[model samples]
Target: MRSKIEQIRMSKKNTADSGIDIIESPEALASQISRAEIFFIKYKKALIGVAIAIVAIVLAFAAYRFYIDSQESTAQSALSNVVYAMENDSLSQALNGSGGNEGLLAIADNYPGTDASNLAHLYAGIALIKQGKFDDAIDHLKSFSSSDLLVQGRAYALTGDAYMEKNQPEEAISYYKKAADYKSNEFFTPVYLMKLGIAQEKAKQPKDAIASYGKIIEEYPLSAEVTNAKKYKGLLEGEVGE
Candidate 1:
């Protein structure tokens, strides 16, 4: 009984013996090798074209990354100045065009695709609201987006303020509620709840307002809003009874 490996070897030997040698001589083998070489040489340009295409794709990607980095850096530099002005409460310098430097508004306008520009939209909206441009503030704030919990919460709160300023109590209450609920934290939650309660009250939803105030009283007893929440709760209960 032959081993498996020996059987495979003997089978291959028998197959080879049964086959006719088409290219028996060294010269014929050389000719066959030369034909293979000719075929490769004929398609050499196509292979080189593929290689060039690959190289071009890599270079194009590198160039795209470089462009993106440059744009981001430029946006960051411009945004930093706007943020400084905003921090200093220089609302005009922060929102309007600041001569050659470009304020938050301009950066948000000119570089719509960048992260810095997106943040600029948010800051610009806040500045517009502070400057009493409620309509413009709403436009900018609506365009702004952020993944950060605090920033998103602040934007929602600011939107509520803008709506409140525009005499849109219903919209204000909705935004205030959103701010209070989004990523609720001990720091901003109580403040947002207070704003929500106030907005709800202004919107003539006394029951909802009472609920918001009760939430503050129950969840954030140590908050400054807690005293006001309890007082408002009592007032709302009295109103309901009458």
Candidate 2:
């Protein structure tokens, strides 16, 4: 039975003769393809329009990217100059545009979409604060946003300082708390905590102020502010003997 089945399968395979064959005549295939081309030619204008549209979109995107790059470069250059002036304590020059050169304010105004522009806003706010323009400083500082915890903390602290200078103790305390809570690391954290405690004291919240100071003494005992924090905490506690 197995032999008969094998012989029958071989006879079927011989009859079918399964093998791929290539077209021997190229001209015949070309003519067939040419007939298909004539059908495609009917929609040639539509296809060309789509291709042109795609090319135009690609070119437009490229041009937009180039414009953004140029703007970023210009903004960065302006920011560097402003930073130099700021570092040298030339607050006026850093805020206001120098002769033929844009300042931080100008970069923030002209290149609103760039990172440099955002940083310029921060610089401008700091410069304005230094110049005793608290309202203007708050305006610029609030407009600036940053994901970096350190920079964000600084911005919040500057805003708090401006509020305190303006005699708005509540707003100052709010910002001080934000700065104190943000990214509770060793460096800025203790300083902001001291500021927060002082602000709380100013706000007439002695208990809260004591708590803030105690937090500094407990968590950041080695910080520079710890000594002051301990003093303030003791004073607030009003413990006479021990």
Candidate 3:
């Protein structure tokens, strides 16, 4: 009995020495609440300032988003009129704006970060190409960017065309390769590959030209360009054999 009593006393003493209270007293809980209240009182102004700063930041971001949306809407509206002019073959009006509508160049310049601005660069580049302004066409085409696979590929091909017009077959070959390789698909890749082969041929690279045409014949056999590719590949192979 004494031993068992001693064991109970040892357990209680060990628990106390460990400083771990399983049941917190009312006074301890009240003391904790008081400390928390004091802390809040001491930093009340700072905490309020932080909250106000966060709210201001949120409001500022919202305002900026709204402003951008409005700008995009205006730009899209303006760009549509210019596109209509282009479709109508009114190149001068499309570029220079005959009436109140801003031309493609103005839209591109006025709205730098908007999607409409980016598309304006593309339309302007194509217009410049039509005007035989090869250098300007290349510059505007290079400035344009898009996530759409078809548009981006077309831009690359247009850049190649501009370079080819400038009598820079090597530069044209590089851009044609980019167009052919980027997001290769059945519809567009064959067209770009044909352009690549032509550029390679002009650059005195018959072997590379043959390979490009072979790719179209083998990989994109159903494409309209496949027949042209086969003809060009045969021609290049004959020239290479000599």
Candidate 4:
């Protein structure tokens, strides 16, 4: 279990350090956030079961791994603080620590092999991205996994966003494509497509960008991203003389 978890972390770091944004529309940010909450709630219930399995793997089956149940709860408590900081945009405090509670780095480091540590990696990655630590964000985000498609898929897109910020649009496009096509959900799929389209445009693949945008329009017509998708696709189409 320890080796397996490390392998996932290493994989993300290797792809990101070796080679390697947001919602599209102004009006959609609010809607996107609400929908994202719904997604999180839906998937979180699923992840609880996965977390149980992970606990079993780390404790009962795995001989090499070690952590206590209380530690897991403690790590989770600290992680909740980190999430609070992240939600409130207190990036520095979230990444490091504040007066009372612990931060993500500590929880993740101290509670290695636990599911809460994995979640710490996810929240830490997001906090790092907000602090402009793109490469580090990729490393942290890659360590995370959940049985929930929404969470895991967003992790892919988050790394893509990190790559995009680093100005490596091709890597960004790759991850964004992974995110856009991942699981095919109603909430995040269109948003991921918008991200993919923008990355395609950045990489000077206008045709591909238009295709991604068109996917949003055709598949997720009611999505908030669809409006911006049409807007950007029209501009790209005109530029391509079509």
* Winning candidate number (lDDT): 3
Tens-digit per-residue lDDT, 11-82, candidate 3? 999889544432356666677789999999999999999999999999999998888788899999999888
Please list the residue runs of candidate 3 whose C-alpha ends up more than 4 Å from where it truly belongs after superposition: 1-60
RMSD of each: 6.4, 6.7, 5.3, 28.2
TM-score for all models, in order of appearance: 0.73, 0.72, 0.78, 0.68
- Total clashes for model 1: 0
- Candidate 1 lDDT tens digits, 1-242: 98999999998987785443435666657777899899989999998999999999999999988887788899999988777788899999887747688888888988767888898889889888888999999999989888797999899999999998888989998888888888998899999999888888888899998999999989988888899899999999999993
Give the alpha carbon lDDT tens digit for every residue of 3-104 in model 4: 988999988886665432124454556667889899989899798899998998877754543346667777878887777778889888988889978888
Report lDDT (Cα) of residue 16, candidate 2: 59
Model 1 TM-score (2 dp): 0.73
**lDDT ranking from best candidate downward:** 3, 1, 2, 4
TM-score of 4: 0.68
Model 4 CA deviation exceeding 4 Å by range:
1-70
Ranking by TM-score: 3, 1, 2, 4
| lDDT at 183, model 3 | 92
Error of 1 at 129 (Å): 0.7
Candidate with top TM-score is 3
**Count: clashes, candidate 3:** 0
